[model samples]
Target: MAKQYSRPSHYEQLMKKLQNDFPGSEPITGLMLIYLKHIVHVVETSSDMIVKIVEDLHNMEQEETSCVAKSKILIISHDIHTRLYQQWSSRTLDIVEHGIEAFDTNETFENLIVDLLTQLLKLAVFLMKQPKLNLKNAMDALHEKVPDLLPQQSVVHYLLEENDSSMSTPSEFLTLYQRPFDTSLESDMVWPIPTRLFPYN
Candidate 1:
């Protein structure tokens, strides 16, 4: 006699458990976390591009070479901008608004952005072997474009230029590094989030 084949009910049970655990908020929370990770990645990548630009500026020993490098930097900047916009738009407002709330809307996200920028600045210093980029101007531009990107108490204000020194070490920016944040912040609230940061606005 042929052995009897048993239908697998294990998967069905597991699926039921997952649905119960998630309840009603898991999908939104999951998507938000994914978007947040991409956002940070994009910002970090863009910051590195700026560092590369600074490096090109310093490495240019001749006017002709400098122009070439500048052209390269411009091209890279344009490319970075395109990438950033694409990623930013793909993220839903529900995720960002929740993130803002999850971070306490105080300065968590702001600090994150500044820390990334500071790292890029330090990388620029090493790659260029000199301080060719104006850190202040770049920061100022960032602030103008994205207000409050750095927390007031964060090191961004004094990382590049302090009262006693003109340049700080890369270690200063490292302080921003934190363990992965909680993805499922509010597991109970199920509502539509308003417009968070409208890129078009």
Candidate 2:
């Protein structure tokens, strides 16, 4: 399950809670795409940990707490053996920075959410297959020397700031709800993904 992306601050709290609740050593690992107000999350963990996380997220939303968020989850692939990632981390890319232009076309937020998740998953697998290439961060790879790493007219558009060193810009910083990104993205193998974003999927 995932929570609807909340304010950067709230998401920050959520990230912190996730880190603290599930330590680095825990078997849980997945990706989080903070797309504007929606969070497309893929959690690869044990069944028990999954339940605990869902319950914790529910309490966070219903308890009138500092962070108000909820998740309507899609089970990408379950009862799997390998984990795609070594640790749990998030990438906050509001590609459509304001969450406005993506809807300028005739598409529901749900559609955009699926598009992002599908795109990112494919991109992850592509990166994994690259020989002698260590593309640790997708956002960083966007601006790096590898033109072949990404396709032209990318749907996942990330605009870096003028000053490369500055992590203050909101648009460039998907790291915080506020840095360009907090952590890089990584994955190991491909897996079957759910097309729908609902639990029914």
Candidate 3:
């Protein structure tokens, strides 16, 4: 009978490998991975819905398609956006609740808080970069994501700028992600309407 080799313990293997990695590499890498994974989850979930809605819209607009089908495909982006926001929010909270202070960063805890905000900014950029969603719709969705910084004037700001122009989305909104207490934003917030008969801003 051939002698079988015993497997090394995971902790032992990790300890052996840590010598090559930086002091905090494991935890930092783990946290970064978690953050990136959450981002991918949100994007994947949102994009999947966006792609389906766009496909439906395209099918409805086809020459042989019926009017009923066209109506069904319209503005489904809002629903997708709403659900995406909810997912991002919940995941963000979970991250915070799970020993958020344990991460080792060069900056103080306050700065780490800022880093969390930047993650939201990255997510917003990712959402807008999705080609299936129009600029107007992207702006609308972003407004929902960052209500405080964007406020009521956000859509107008988004509209006033050229579609190709790059604007940095705010990070402040991410601080509220996944919190235990319910936010009071709902009562005070109001999304602006075009208010014109022709729908021109």
lDDT per model vs. reference: 0.29, 0.47, 0.30
Report residue 165 deviation for candidate 2 (angstroms): 46
Cα lDDT tens digits, model 1, 10-44, are 22343345446556622111000112212111222
- Per-residue lDDT tens digits of candidate 3, residues 9-61? 32234333443443433221111112211221122233333343234334433
Candidate 1: worst 10 consecutive residues by lDDT? 28-37
For residues 65-89, write the lDDT of model 2, one tens digit per residue: 5243444433335668656565455
Off by over 4 Å in 3: 1-103, 133-201
TM-score of 2: 0.48
- In terms of TM-score, the best-performing candidate is 2
Worst 10 residues of 3 by lDDT: 28-37
RMSD of candidate 3 to true structure, Å:
24.5
TM-score list, all predictions? 0.17, 0.48, 0.19
lDDT of 1: 0.29
Candidate 2 ranges beyond 4 A from true positions: 1-26, 97-120, 130-133, 139-201
